[model samples]
Target: MSDALRDRCEELRAVVLELTTTTIEAMGKPSKLADVVTVIGKLRAIGDKGAAGIDNPDYLAWDRVYDASLQKMEDAARRGDAQEAWRAFADQETGVNLIARACTGYPGW
Candidate 1:
């Protein structure tokens, strides 16, 4: 991977980690809803920005998975369904792991 692509992958990984941590920490806490939404939005933005200019099929596939998960999370958030949101976030976390593996040859969790 080029340095820029590697950097973007790292950035996405960090956002995914932070999102996962925050979601777990905020579980059952209504006061943290806004924060979770913000993080989700940030993750989506990162995914959107990084999705362009990738010619690798594996990475592209994983990226699509990530985007789909984000959409599910967003829909759940809009419906005020925290449990579903959490599930979607978990799915997204998997996608993030796959993306990391595809981009950096790291063993996925």
Candidate 2:
């Protein structure tokens, strides 16, 4: 990968980690469902953008996983299931790390 692509991959990973951490922290309080959903939406958008230039199968696979996990997180948040939402968010985080590794040869987490 070029330096630019590797840098983009790192940026994507950082964004994912930040959003996941924020969502997890917000789960401890009530009325944070909207915030969590918003973060997940951002994550989905980021994943879509981040995957656009990649041709690696592993990166693409994990990108899809990240997208699906974001959807699951959003659904769980809507249902007021904090536990499930957290679980999905964790999966999203893992997906992000895997994608970073696949693309940049480093676990950006």
Model 1 pairs in collision: none
Candidate 2 Cα outliers beyond 4 Å, as residue runs: 55-58, 92-108
Write the residue-wise lDDT of candidate 1 on 10-106 in tens digits. 6776676777776666577755656678888888787777656666665677676776777777677667677777887765344454665556653
lDDT tens digits, residues 3-109, model 2? Answer: 64565566677666666676677678646877788877766776777666666666667766776767887898888887778777655345454654565564554
* Candidate 2: Cα lDDT at 89: 61
lDDT of each: 0.67, 0.68
Q: Top model by lDDT, which number? A: 2
Error of 2 at 97 (Å): 4.4
User: What's each prediction's TM-score?
Assistant: 0.70, 0.69
